[model samples]
Target: DMEIKNTNTIQYRSMVDKLIFLTNIRLDIAFVVPYVSKFMQTPQQTHLWAMKGILQYI
Candidate 1:
């Protein structure tokens, strides 16, 4: 699988950081949040999609 770097790096990182904070109260997302956070430095479109899905889940 090819991973394309996200152009909206700042936005992605910001959202992921928010998710990281959410993980404390939202136990269900604890696992997934860290998984997505791994890509924060170089998030791809897929990563952003995952973040959106997480937001929808919340």
Candidate 2:
């Protein structure tokens, strides 16, 4: 089994970028994408939890 590491600079950037692009077509995720982006500099467990919740909403 492997543990999931929530923070990976390149991967996180890539994902956030994709989410930003998706925002154009999915207005519903717009707010959440930016919301998640703000924590990129120093993401914490709570931020990841929030993002998961947002994803579930979407």
Compose the digit string of candidate 2's lDDT tens values, residues 1-58. Answer: 1234434544455667777887888898986787789878656667666766765676
What shift in Å separates residue 41 of candidate 1 from its native position after superposition?
Answer: 1.3
Q: Candidate 2's error at 15, in angstroms?
A: 4.1
Winning model by TM-score: 1
Best by lDDT: 1
lDDT per residue (tens digit) for residues 12-32 in model 1: 989988988998899989888
Q: What pairs collide in candidate 1?
A: none
Write down the TM-score of every candidate: 0.81, 0.62
lDDT for residue 58 in candidate 1, whole number 0-100: 97
